[model samples]
Target chain A: MLSVDIRKTLGAFQLQTAFDAPEGVTVLFGRSGSGKTSVVKSIAGLLTPASGRIALGARTLFDDGSRINVPVHKRRFGYVFQDSRLFPHLSVRDNLCYAARVSDRGGRSPDHVADLLGISHLLDRRTHALSGGEAQRVAIGRALLTEPDMLLMDEPLASLDGPRKAEILPYLEMLRKETGLSILYVTHNMAEVARLATHIVLVEEGRVVRSGAPDDLLTDPDMVRLLGIRDAGAVLSAAVTAAPEDGLSELAISGGRLFLPAVEAPVGATLRVRILAQDVILSTTRPEGMSALNILPVRVLAVRRGDGPGVIVQLQAGHDRLLARITRRSADALGIAEGTECYAVMKSVAVSQTDIAVGLQSGL
Target chain B: MTDWLGPEEWQAVLLSVKVSFWATVLSMPLGLICAMALARGRFLGRDVLNWLVHLPLVLPPVVTGYLLLLSFGRRGPVGSFLYDTFGITLAFQWTGAALAASIMAFPLMVRAMRLAIEAVDPRLEEAAATLGANRVRVFSTVTLPLILPGIIAGAVLAFAKAMGEFGATITFVSNIPGETRTIPSAIYAFLQVPGGESSALRLVAVSVVIAIGALILSEWLSRRVAKRISGA
Candidate 1:
């Protein structure tokens, strides 16, 4: 377990955050200038906190009260910056070996990390010649060669284009699963959070407002406000119950049944489904002859106004609270309020297969 | 055919080369240190140190030479103390001429090196620190290699400036044949005599050739270093 409870004051910005991350990918999610990078830097010992205690497992990395502050180099935490920060004078091979040669820990080898990151072919090339995705891959390899106890990635994909981000996400997922290295990933992108995060720590104004499983927070109404109305959604874990012949697959969510576009996963395999708030339509009574394939009988739990002209309706289908956004006029016409009964209607084709991600075991 | 250059012209050529070479070699390390300090160090009186480093550039060369002579001449306080303690002498010697040339050229060397050092990204140093390199090791392996082109440029500028140094060398060390006489001093001597115009013109031509050669060599060295560092 890696735990950080730090408080630092820099001019006008005050950072007082406390969070314990288990041995998995704990993503710090927030908008820009929200102190996400500050928290990660504090954990990596790049920025010293005025007063706090930082510990990783049995070792005490920092304690301001005791006047114990380890230097950044000796802290032995691998940090991958957004710019990659590769040594311009060194070849890719030398850049990968730099940390390993200097690290006090003797377990990690440079060749092993290079092989793991799949950059053996580009080892002899200069750093400036590599593409953006390739540079990040080499940066990851350089960090891993240090044999750090934990890894801190600060928006490593923010500099890349969307396609480049897509190219690197799978490698990050592989790193998380294959190495089982405790990772503290900082990102502002919600799509990455939905795909890779096991736990999400919501940060705003230099403070952590909430921390929990990704599915729990992704559907929370308060979290929807943090993520904004356009990106609000419900993350549901489902098991592929059956693969029907009509290009649709039945999924068993916690509260009700969901039908998604045909997925390649075999029957009985678990998958995650993301149903966007804007895509959901609520009706007071069961409608007939509609093309929508899935409808859940739900009770209106709460009603709240969104950022613009829309009203957010919280519904309890089974054990999950699904959010739906509709204009205020529609809410009034449909008479949607708390304790009202409604059928949540969504097309099977609208439940995209790409949104259905398969999660691995917790430790993996 | 006999050699075109006369004996006096040849002496001036040889002495100028020796003086400028020694001046550049002696001042390069000090120039690098001062450049690094000015570029990287954050300390009290940094602006004052910066002004002092550039003082030789703005001040008249004769004034700078006079100051050096006051501090380093055999009879002056610092000079006399050294002479009394260690029997060292710098007044009216070729070494004094070299010292004057170095002092006059120091600013150019530091400016080139400072620009080069400043051009390097500090983020790379931070990255090196995270890689477990100490401050000294990071500077040696990363900072020095990155700034090498600037160092070469600075050295060449200093050497070229040392070759043409006149007012300072004459004021500090004086013109002594076979001792403190360099190209500029020899030119001055030939100008003083009505019959030595041809020798002075030939010596001036040699000076021009040396300056051009130094500039070409510096360019070649800088490109080689840049290519090596950039791995291109």
Candidate 2:
């Protein structure tokens, strides 16, 4: 477990945050200028806080009361920045082995790391010759070779294009599952939060507003306003039940069988699917759907009204909580309130390929 | 080529090369230290140190030599202390000439190196530190390799400047045939005689070749190092 409670004042921006990260991936989710990066930097010892204590398991990394601020190199925490900070003078292989060579405590070989990141073929190439995605992969590999106590990633995918981001997310997922190293990932992108976050810490204006498992916080109606109502959604864990047919694959969730776009994972593999609140249509009764494929029987858990005409309706479908963004008129007409029964009508095509995350069942 | 010049003229050529070589080689470590301090250090007296390092570039070479004589002469404070403690003297000796040349060349060396150090991204060093590299390791592995081309350029510039050094060398250490007489001093001595024009011309040719050769060599070395660093 990694515990961080730090307070820093940079000009007018005063940041105070406290959070705990267990062995899984804990994502610091916030918009730009929310001080998420500052938290990560403080954890990595890149920026010293004015006051607080930080510790990893039994080791105290920083403490103002004790005046025991461990230096960055001695902390043994791997950090991957937004930009791929590979040394230009070094080949990919040398960059991967840099921390190992310096620390003389390499836990993994360069060849093994390269293979894990799918960069074995590019080891001899110069960093300048690599594509953006490949360079990031090498950067990740470089960090992993150190065998750090924890990994700190500060929006590593923010600089890449869509296709490039798609290319690197799988490697990150694999790292999370295979390494079992506690990771602190920071990003403002909601899609990234839904896909990567096992635990989510919501940061706002240098303060942690709320934090919990992705399933709980994402489905809470009170958090809709903070999570960018349009991007607010719940992550549903399901296992692939059938192979892809007609560009759709069937997955079994606690709610019911969900057919989404062709997920890359094979049958029997569990996956996390992000359902956007805006994409879900709430109906009072199970109406005969003409074209929409999914209509699950649900009971309204809570009704949250935003400043606009839209209201976020939280529903319980079997054991999973789902959110639907419906206007005031629709909510009034459907009589949607706490304990009201409804059917969440969702078109099968609304869920994009990017919304699906291939989660490893056992590791999670 | 061996017999193209007399023994005295050859002595001047060899001695000049020797003085300039010592000047450049001996001053390098200190030059690098001063350059790093000027570029990255944030202590008090940083501005004063910067001004002091550049004083030789702007001051009259004769004045610089005079100051050296007053401060480092045998009877002077540093000079007398060295003589009494270590039994070393630099007055009118060949070593004095090398000292003069190095002082004259120090500014150029420091300037080139400082610019190179400034051009390096500090972020790379921070990344190395986060990757388990201590300060010494970061400097050796990242900072030193990145600034190697600049160091080479600075050394070569100082060498060239030392080779052509005239006013200070002549003022600090008087011309001695086999001891202190460098290429410029030799050319001056040869020109002072009635039938010494040809010898002076030969020495002039030698100085010009050395200066141009140093420039070209520095340029080539810097370009090669830069290319390698950029991964070309």
- Model 1, residue A342: what's the lDDT? 90
Model 2 interface RMSD, one decimal: 1.7
lDDT of 2 at B191: 90
Q: Which stretches of candidate 2 lie over 4 Å from their true place?
A: A362-364, B224-232
Residues A1-364 of candidate 2: C-alpha lDDT, one tens digit per residue: 9998999998899899998987788999998999998898899888999999999999999999999999999998889999888998888989987867876674788898899999999989989899989999998988888888889999999999999999999888889878888889999899988888888899999999999998999999999888998899888888899988887888887888888876788999988887899999997767783688877899999999878899999999889999999999899987889999878988897765577876556223
Checking candidate 2 for backbone clashes, the offending pairs are none
Residue B162 of model 2, lDDT score: 96
Q: DockQ for all models, in order?
A: 0.51, 0.69
Lowest lDDT sum, 10 consecutive residues, model 1 chain A, at: A355-364
lDDT score, candidate 2, position B52: 92
**Reference-based lDDT, residue A81, model 1:** 94
Report the poorest 10 consecutive residues by lDDT, candidate 1 chain B.
Answer: B223-232
Interface RMSD of each: 2.2, 1.7
Q: What is candidate 2's CAPRI-style docking category based on DockQ? A: medium
